[model samples]
Target chain A: MNEIRIFSPATVANVSCGFDVMGFCLDSVGDEMVIRKVERKGIHITRIEGFDLPYEAEKNVSGVSALAMYDAIDVDFGFEIEIYKKIKPGSGIGSSAASAVGSVFGMNELLGRPFNKTQLTEFAIKGEALASKCEHADNLAPAMFGGFALVKSVSPLVILEIPSPEDLYATIIHPQIEIKTAESRALLPKEVALQDATTQWANFGSLIHGLHTGDFEVIKNALHDVIVEPHRSKLIPYFNEVTKAAINAGALGSGISGSGPSIFSLSKGIENAINVKDAIEKVYAKTGIDFDIHVSKINSKGIKIIN
Target chain B: MNEIRIFSPATVANVSCGFDVMGFCLDSVGDEMVIRKVERKGIHITRIEGFDLPYEAEKNVSGVSALAMYDAIDVDFGFEIEIYKKIKPGSGIGSSAASAVGSVFGMNELLGRPFNKTQLTEFAIKGEALASKCEHADNLAPAMFGGFALVKSVSPLVILEIPSPEDLYATIIHPQIEIKTAESRALLPKEVALQDATTQWANFGSLIHGLHTGDFEVIKNALHDVIVEPHRSKLIPYFNEVTKAAINAGALGSGISGSGPSIFSLSKGIENAINVKDAIEKVYAKTGIDFDIHVSKINSKGIKIIN
Candidate 1:
């Protein structure tokens, strides 16, 4: 086919106990993109709606990722792109990742799927680096391959797709505030105590086991962050209150979604996720901050073709 | 019912990428112990053989663990322990754990199993602390529950039992040298770079996934230790050469078994394990170090009842 339309998902990165390594996709929140093959020999952005982002092909994340994929292939025809951005930028929910994954995923489909998930992630992360100022695949992997993605390494780029429980759901709260990725990252210390690192890895290993075994109790116990959250959470208002509210409302666990300004909690079912969302909403309402909340099932499919 | 004989398996702990948290049991290397009940009201050590150890109930590891178990229960009779120890102390292959696990496992069986595995691990770690000078369950959990064990946490201890591949085998080479656990631990840096910690946890999470899916390639790639190996390997002479030899001989991965002196390598089958053992032995032979090599299958059953 010469044309393709796809739904590229929003994702939660820096999952508790799995900072810089783990992330999962969301089904209910995403961005829509359409790509069409043209006879010309260059990539072009035909339209963008709902968010003011750089429209220049070289400046946009979608364009950068598409260029990364496009350069690796021998395609005679060029591509035209249109994006309907719904996941806001700097909301800590992988807005840039959606754009980055969308372009590569759609281009691959249009080219009859020449690249695998790992290659797609490599190309997507190049675009992700433009936004985060650092290259990490935690968000890109899940948005590209779906379910739970564990980025085992970044240099060699190994992404392990872990199975999520069928009933698992996510509740996300995105406060409409911008926390620059570089500034948020600067809040972290360059070094961490060895003892704390051990605890983090222990919980990380246990969380992976819990997901495999479908044991909610293990998941609940394992969802703790001793490394990153203690520092970054201070940047987001009501962060502690929202997390406590989510847990009290029956979330398995809750933590800062990515850098800041967005928080996520995971639960067993849609009903419980809704309860967590409601509880978080009540906590955030008093802060006088404009925010958006979403309840999503774990998106096992990642980026998907759409009509 | 008054008397019980058991074989308590030795364990390899601090498996690469899972320091202080992961371990596995060995079928061919362990200690044999016999425990019997008497009309008295306290725990006692009746005989010692094969290895020299304290005979008192409180000072000996076997006795210490048994007393811990005995005091928590309303047992009507005192216990007598006869040890036919085969594992050497300071060998870094869970010699103390075998002794510690033996008394509790035999006593639990004799008392009709009043405590669960976690409780038993708790009691066993107390005995392990006598040897290691710290409380960590990497070895104890594997010796008690068998196969692979991940000590997910210490306080509110959580041990996750991971399934081993059917054909997995271990090759252990113990160079007859001494490295005290306390001294070995002191060589480590109290703080580690965040980048190194991230790399460690990534490999750790991937290793757990590899074990679950029985993927040898994933296991080979994931079996790495960036944090502890660089420092600890210095204590073990010809460490890098032995590890290289094992890998060259087709072992999946190799690292320091515990604190030091003993090096362990994992292979896919008994034949590969033997090949790895030969390779390791060849390297250590030139060093003029008196060493013992053991090839054993993965012990799925931790402590077995013996005649």
Candidate 2:
């Protein structure tokens, strides 16, 4: 094939108690990219649409991820790429990961799929590195594999796909505000109280158990973030009010999505997801934050070829 | 209904990555208790067998647990108990939990079962408080509920029973050495590096995913302890050697069972569990530590009435 179009789903990283480790793909919001094989011996970005991101190939996340993949397989193919950035940058919902994951995902297909999911993940994390000065797969893995994922180890790159309950729905509220991922991360403590860490991991363990067993009660009880949320929630306006509204609206659990400005809640079904969105909007509407609400089931089929 | 006999299985708490939160039960090693309802109006330990545990009603773990249950129910009936200590105390396993669980379990049967598992767990944790300085259900929950458990919160008493893979087996090596639980716990840092805590919880998340999905490779990859084990492993003799031997013998993972004299390894089946035992014995036999090895399937039944 001369060209392929791929859509990479937006993802919520650090899903509450599982900071820097857990993430899930979302169906409603995503980024689209088109890669076409060209006679030129070098990669080029033909056009960048929808956002005012850098056009320099070396600086863009997609370009960096493609370069990583090219280095990994030593491929001789050159491609022209067009990025349709639908997932807004600095959205705290893995906008960069979509570009990173989409680039490598498309590159693997264009190079006859030499790399596996894990290998592709390794190259894709470079996109995060370019964006945040650190390589983390919490976002990239879910964007590539779909569903819930646990990045067990980053060095050897062990990412496990956790089972998502079939009845689960995701409700995300992006308040049209920017919280830079790097700055949000910098807000976290360099050290944590041992007791708080224990509690956090305990919640993390329960969350994974709940996801696998489809026990909504366990998930509800375990959706606590003692480590990151306390530090990052202050950056988002009305975080506590919005989260409480989602929970009161029958969300199984709710917390800041990624670094926030976007808060998400997991519900048992679509109707409850809409309810949670409406409730959070009520809280945000009073603040006049110009928000967008997304209600969708978890995107379990991550980045996919459109045509 | 005059007398009852109950056995509570021993447990491996902390389970590498889940310090103070996760634990699983063992079938082969346990404690046995016999409770007889008497005409008196208070709880009493009439006979203590097999070990020189404190006979004082408030001092003993079993006594404390029984008293806690009595206080909760405000029972008027008195009970006399006999204890047979099989699980060694200060061996890093849930020896005290077995006693606490067995006493409450036997007492509940004697009283026509007034409380459920969670209620029983609450009373049982009082035994831990009596034994140590604080109330923790990491050991008691698994012993009472069976299989793997995550103590999501100790304050609200949230304990979730995690599903266990049927093929999983546990191999434990109690090397006739005692590491006082208090001292071992004291060895832990009051605070931990944020990066290490994140890695530990990430592993905890993956481990739960592996257990729920029955993915052995994910379990193997996630069987890491970056928090407590690094600090406590130094207290155990041949900790590194025994762990390596178990891994070489095809054990999926191995680590300090709780807070150090006992080390446990998990394997896929009975054969591998026994193989792990043999390998560990080869290392410990040279040390002349008078070790005892128990290889058993993951005990799904926690406290059972033997009648």
Model 1 DockQ, alpha carbons vs. true complex = 0.90
Runs in model 2 with CA error above 4 Å? A74-76, B74-76
TM-score of chain B of each: 0.98, 0.97
Query: What's the distance in Å from true for residue A206, model 2?
Result: 0.6
* TM-score of predicted structure 1: 0.99
Candidate 2 chain A: worst-modelled 10 consecutive residues by lDDT: A68-77
Q: Per-residue lDDT for A1-307 in model 1, tens only? A: 9899999999999789999999999999999999999999778999999899888878999999989888999878899999999999888889999999998899888888899989998998888888878888899999999999999989899999898799999999999988876788799989999999999999999999999989998899999999999999999988999999999999999999988688999999999999999999999999899999999999999999999
Give the per-residue lDDT of model 2 (tens digit) for B177-280: 77776678789999999999999998998888888888898888889999988889988999999999999999999999988688999999899998999999
Q: Each model's number of backbone clashes?
A: 0, 0
Write down the TM-score for model 2: 0.96
Q: Return the lDDT, model 2, position B197.
A: 97
DockQ agreement of candidate 2 with the native complex: 0.90
Clashing pairs in 2: none
> Ten residues in a row with the worst lDDT in model 1 chain A?
A176-185
Best by TM-score: 1
The local distance difference test score of model 1 is 0.92
